[model samples]
Target: MADQPPIPFHRGHFLFGSTFSLLRDSLGLLRQLQQQYGDQRVVRIKVGRRMITVLLKPEETKYVLQENNRNYGRGRSYKILREFLGDGLLTTDGDYWRRQRRLAQPAFHRQKLALLADTMIDEAVSWTSQLQRLDKTQPVDMSAALMEATLRIVTKTLFGSGLGDQTTRLSQALNDLNHIISQTVLNPLRLPNWVPTPANKSYINASGLVTDLITGIIRERRQSTGKHDDLLDMLLRATDEETGEGMTDAQLLSELVTLFTAGHETTAASMSWTLYLMATHPDVQARARAEALRTLGTRTRFSADDLRAMPYLTQIVNESLRLYPPAWAMSRLSLGPDQLGAYHLNADEGVLISPYLLHHDPASWPNPDQFDPNRFAPDRSADRHSYAFLPFGGGPRLCIGNQFALMEMVALLGQLLVTFELQPITSEPMLPRPLITLRSKQPIRLYLRDWPV
Candidate 1:
């Protein structure tokens, strides 16, 4: 065993190792890894007592995420999210995760989320209309705009009655949790969750506010005899086929928080990147707008059924995801010794898979640097490997809300393009920040100009 050649190590400070670089600019570090080590090499990243082997190729990702999926589980960073999401599907393992997946699976079924498309369209309309209140010449922070809009759609879809006026309060709480957790997980002196230090207090307070809000909604729903025909009702009615048991209040709250955070955050990030791509490529934007108008007719709001015919719009969205997958990197812990390519991995070792690297691999994607939506054109995509493009991930644990997000994006973009065209307002280039989710380090600024009918 000792005779096995050593995997390449990313050299760094003796004490901190790759810790600072990983937190500061993860995408850059990943690209550097890919450039220096190629796709298959097992690269070592150690800081303190922790070690992770970065896996950048698709086949290896397929092996861990699908082929022998049971041998791996969610990474350590997920512990921070468990503070907010509890033991929901995203953070659970073994039969528990499988059971939860079954219960929530029916809620996001194709026909069900399809019915919620009108709700998404209505929400988009309300948000788009608010643009009138802003000065057209002023640079709008589209990242915040889309984040707020998607967050509203996700909450409303689950609760039937949107966040309403509590939108600001809930949004701020979530924002605080996401940022605090991402930074806290890296802090060497981070206190325990139960501690009353300033940081701990803030996380607890924000988490409690979120908990109270969800609990109130659940209690209200339980008292009602009428059916809402929404995600919550589906969940409340779901029973374990094996035990005939239902999720407890504590369980339901965790799942609710998971759905609330994961459902909106990734979709919003994708939409932000999409807006930037559209602005930078005027021709693609104009053609996409024209196609959207042509298919949508004069209607201000489009339907889920309407999304089926818009091929170009799908390409645009697919391309954006290729360039900037919201869940840029995911981690899994190996349950046993295994062979990943030529490297042997021991039990309990952490593995990192970067979709950002796989999607841009020149072998799989031609001229990967260019923003060409045609790469997703039906005929062109037919020959590509399924794992090659993983914005929503793949395998049994693929994002349950993928279809919902795609439909929601279509509704938002379709409604938006019908009345407006997005134009880039900032001369600076956009940079990706790989936190809990990938986000722009700086605001993705743009001007929304209304177009004639």
Candidate 2:
């Protein structure tokens, strides 16, 4: 057997017998697998008819995400996303992704984002207004509230108009769509739009609503001569610098959907976790609140300039992302054979890297599970490798909206900390659901007591 060709480990019977088992406790299972097999172990697990290898170690993750990125494409997991995103930056590969990234670059520039900061703060105020009316004695679903807030900000920033009446309906559709994509990973059947499984039906209907909303916005923008300079306006006016060609309506629609889905959902999850952490860690919360008050004074409003000046607030956001990265696991299919540490990865094989695992790894992080924002402090920095905390990912394909997401998060959190003292409702642990993004399986509930100056 030692001289014979090595067989990839097949724990097929165990996996097949427990379809829901892996799904139910995925984070726990991945941790156990990494501990037992030491990072590079190859195990075959079925996703419909196909088998996929789940890579756990940081070294292997770096190679797949950065070193050998060319050897991999975005892979099959993003197909459903493409139905909504339509060859947008996240789903496309090679030249297509590069082109979209270039075109979309200008809108996300720091200067442009600085201008959008006013809009973001306005939306933040609108969000907190709803919470102001909530009774301090009542437990509120911070996750849902954060989702609504971030969605409003992203939509307004992207479209320059309130989503208005469509807000609740669109929010529900997005929630359903996210659920379907995550669940379908284990049951990968490529059914047509006509097929009627509850999941598939939800996906089709939700995607159609999103697509229609985007199409209407695009049509209105095309007809108007006004220059709003918002993201949608910028996208509408963008001509390929080289070819002088604008994105097709379909392409534009896809990107709008992608932005709405990727841009909002992840930010919402990150803020929810941040608030939960703040609630559980009162000292940290007090420090953050003090910092916000010191920076903003008695002002009810904060601007981008004020947000930039708040370093401690930035640390809280960074630490929250470290603990619960929104885009938790990333996968790529190898384009050519390559050497990854001690193992030989074959061309066409799928490679997976989970930030959820790497962020909590004890080897890289001291007191790995502790909620310590000071780890990000300049003087006592954790002194880890660059890829160790890739909540936004890395390389050329690093998330384009990283700056936008961070600024939005810091601005909102800073504002909230000043207005309310958050306290956790349940002592139950906040379990993570590894879907399209890392999200809390249960809504993060918090008591929002008004802060007295």
Model 1, TM vs. native? 0.95
lDDT of 2 at 436: 78
Please give the clash total of every predicted structure, in order.
0, 1
Give per-residue lDDT, candidate 2, residue 300: 75
What Cα-based lDDT does every candidate model obtain? 0.83, 0.80
TM-score of each: 0.95, 0.93
Worst 10 residues of 1 by lDDT: 182-191
Error of 2 at 36 (Å): 1.8
> For model 1, what is the alpha-carbon lDDT of residue 70?
90
Query: Per-residue error at 223 for model 2, in Å?
Result: 0.6
Top lDDT model: 1
**Which residue pairs come into collision in candidate 1?**
none
- Candidate 2 residue spans exceeding 4 A from truth: 1-21, 39-51, 189-192
lDDT string for model 1 (90-173, tens) is: 888899999999888988888888778888988888998987678897889998998899888988898887777888888888
